[model samples]
Target: MKLHEKPLIRYATSKTPVDKEGHLYKKGERNTSYQKRWFILKGNLLFYYDKRSDREPLGVIVLEGCSVQLCESNENYAFDIRYEGPGIRTYKLAAEDQRTQEAWVKALLWANFSRLRMLVQDLERTYEQVRVDSGPRHRLTVLGIESEQVTTHLGRPVHGRAATHRPAPSTFTSEPLENFVELHERYRKEVDAVRQEWLSKRNQQHGDPPVADLVDLN
Candidate 1:
């Protein structure tokens, strides 16, 4: 079995109050209002939600949305779609926590990449089995032959039919190995690109000299 590339599928859904905020609501908090919504960002669809708490500085709500982008330069994008009762606000996560955002960004990228890898492996196995089953001569049939003066003959079974071959164990192993290798390579490249993007955005936010500037020649 050989692993081949396939398009990635994204699954997105939303629920009222969302997961995290819902937990908080269950904790006897009456002053907070929570709402959940779903929408597509770039190309990937995600669930976005937040809870409003009545406290000084107004407890901040973290709204999140994710999507996959095919553009070589941008493989995925995520943003916060913030809403405060009657008014709606949209903000890019990149704008906040410039120094430590890569951790979160990498996490999301890895999750999506992992799902794509699993799908590829499953597809490869199915295709390989199908090809093996379609081989020539599924079952042999006996034909009559002339005997004596009469053109009559009897037919009998010679060899028992072979059971569908259980695709060699090796075949199953090879496909996933190849898929993992390819997936790892692709994921590595994508991760690097995404990390670099984050770094660039972070640098832009601070408008400081590159990290190299902080190094002393002494």
Candidate 2:
């Protein structure tokens, strides 16, 4: 659907991340003629302008449930951005070359909010798992020999509770663990902040009310 919504335009600016921007020949629905327009893609919204200098966009396409694919056409590097909903027009576009066409298609496909959210969640899970795995207990558990036997530099076996208390391995230093924890905490804080910022920006773009409260990261 084509919309020149103010909220969308405002959201497009205001320090939003630009995923891609370029010139493309767009096939007009009524005229059936290709016109080159400047397009800027920010998150899921694709905004187009008659010229690159225009402050206001001609229209914006919300690519939430849209799909981009190559289309058979006389024009080289032609593709279509299609939405399944009623009243939504399929956008026909052509890039300069095959490489550019593929890049744009890839960017549009991954621009869907659902896909981006899933990617963010997956990264968070991976980071958390790494942090857990870096802990002393987990490292010891993985090194089964550490639990079964404790030995000295001289290769003598230890016995009882005293035997179990072997010095920490040189590989596992407190300094490195402390550094990892600090970096992990910083990364978590940054991710949480960016996630909240995205939520706010999304709400603004959709004209929805601001979220009542941020999710607890603890």
Candidate 3:
């Protein structure tokens, strides 16, 4: 949808801690550079402001259909949120550490998929009703358009029999939210397990001490 036509729903919000700085970088000559802005994830919307608890947001990135990538530490130790939405483009945000970057990624993904889960539930309910009311022999009226069959499988409509009594196959191992939580936990474990090696490789390539190099040790 168009930016102007987008809905404003605040599902969640978080920010960087004092010890761990966060930055919202806009694309410019210095794409790797960091900007001082408080990052907040509200549902699928990521907003930034000049300061904590700011009234107006500087910009927003709709995480729906967006892809995220963590830049190599040697470069900037920042992450990119690439979105194909409206006039806004990819956003490069810097976090204090790998953990922080992961946090942002996790939050953004949850927001995106959580919204999706809700949409899926709504669609499933509607599909179930249609399957029941329109039996295999009855034509279905949808959007004012009559159809020989709508769908029974949410994939195909059976022409001979209506399996309305059958409940939709349960795909989730548990509740959708619970499944997400489990996945998020798995992600954290995996990331933490590789914390040492990943940081070693990243820092080594990052020169280990880019800042200290600016000064002479002799």
Candidate 4:
């Protein structure tokens, strides 16, 4: 049995945010000829249209669990969207140029939720650690708190430019020194642990010969 595109039709204008939208030549499954189509990539979905002004997609491809790869074909800048499962046909597409091909391939790979979710998780963890390490005062300074007020006060007309207004004494209680001590200790431990792990792996890969491997006949 041969695959057909009739079953792939999901006729509706997608309201999802589009990651990439461009024209690409798609290889016809039946005709084996390349056809110019307007391609729109939303999250985990690749929708194509016969015309760019078309209100609905001609077909929608669920990109989940599928792999996009550059392939050698008669067409230039050809790539394949392959899935190792039944009933789903591999989509072959080609871009106008090498730059467009690379861009489309990268966009398609990043179109999946799994890839975006991992990226979001990594960013969250990294920013969360930065938040934890920074003090409240430091965070407030970063947010420009009290900066405008200070600037306004300083910019006011004074007796002389050399005799600017002196800032009032700070009434806020200083953060505990113990907190800094604890923070330093925690960071030191984490760094030491990471260094040790790296050294262990390095030694396993390129350490000196073992005692058992060394022998003296003398």
Candidate 5:
């Protein structure tokens, strides 16, 4: 999906200690300290933003079968809500400072779309590996396509009813195997291209400097 077209959300947290330096007062003096913070997303997605004030957020981590949705109260008023999973309560955004809200929005967008795309690429790699390991004998028939009747390598019927009926071959022909390999390679390259493009766009948006080489201090 296009970046602008995708839904955006925000979540933030902040903390302030009552005292930064330890109290060096009378022995009977009482000192109490506490932290105040909260987090929310897309105007209604709320959660406890637990983190240190000096550190960037670890980010929103979605679990298995989790998904985000955009709901509208009116024709033009909409909010992005994230679901934990089926039949679970959703987290909503809460009140936050303007700067915190903006930062959260940026992080949310990156996590929702860019991170998700990376995960898709990983899954694609796993799928390609499984396909390769399973060999070429497996045929994927499209729905509504006619099923072909063929004989197995052992000279038994593949799909017809008979006393000696056996299953079809598990591997594909040399030509099909080569084609599959080529397609898998092309898909990997495409994924890499898209990832690089995304990284470039993110760097431009954030005004981040290009990666620097590591120095050997030793």
Candidate 6:
């Protein structure tokens, strides 16, 4: 199946929620600065609403090219999601408690990773679509996937914002083995960094000892 032809399997949800929580922000005068909302993580999009069955979503946050960082303590379980994509945005949100906040962060990271892996798989699938091949090896690759480019460093979108991004133009190249090898090394380091971060967080959640310093990624 083509990239867009595949089913949308992005799913994220916060297990804990505060009743009728409102995202604190300002509007015009004579209007209440806050509105009641239900924040939810579903698929690759983090959206919220007055209710689950509501026809229109208050906002949608794309998981691609996004990153999430848990915030310091606040009255609301405050945290931030930063998006580095074309429609760049940083979202500030708070939940009822720490559990809810942690859940949100984990869900966001998982969804973002899923999106990144999908892109990688799509690139591998595109190997058959290549019109050019690299030197004698006859290799075709763009992501051949050097790791830095595939990080799940997603961005955040505001609750009241609409999706305003267009697909980026393709930049595939049929580079030689040396280029691919260099890319592999670079991406390998980046992937290791991300893997370490994930492992640290995962260990903390599992109440387990730290992983060994040396890892055989192969």
- In TM-score terms, which candidate is top? 2
Question: lDDT per residue, candidate 5, 76-193, as tens digits?
Answer: 1122334444665443332123343334433343334333334444535544454444455433221222113111111221221111112221211122222333444544554444
TM-score of each: 0.26, 0.52, 0.48, 0.48, 0.27, 0.44
Off by over 4 Å in 4: 1-14, 113-218
Residues 1-218, candidate 2: write the lDDT tens digits: 46556788788666787889999889988879889999999888889889999887888877765656566765677777886678878888888876677677766765663333444345456444544433433222111233123121112221111111122211111222223334345545644555556566678789988776544544
Per-residue error (Å), model 5, residue 156: 51
**In model 1, which range of ten residues has the least summed lDDT?**
149-158
Worst 10 residues of 3 by lDDT: 157-166
TM-score between model 4 and native: 0.48
Each model's C-alpha lDDT?
Answer: 0.28, 0.60, 0.46, 0.56, 0.32, 0.45
Name the top lDDT candidate: 2
Better of 5 and 6 by TM-score: 6
How does candidate 6 score on lDDT?
0.45
Query: Once superposed on the true structure, which residue ranges of model 6 sit more than 4 Å away at CA?
Result: 1-36, 85-87, 128-218
Candidate 1 local lDDT, 1-218, one digit each (tens): 01121211112222222222111111103422222222122222222323333111112322222221111111022222233354443332321232222333333333333444455444334333433444432221112211121111111111211212221111011222224445444433433444445456668989965553221211
Model 5 accuracy (lDDT, Cα): 0.32
Query: Which model is ahead, 1 or 2, in terms of TM-score?
Result: 2
For model 1, name the residue pairs that clash. 44-67, 44-68
On residues 188-215, what C-alpha lDDT tens digit does candidate 3 reach at each position? 3433333334445557877774222222
Provide the lDDT at 184 for model 3: 35
Best of the two (5, 6) by lDDT: 6
- Sorted on TM-score, highest at the top, how do the candidates line up? 2, 4, 3, 6, 5, 1
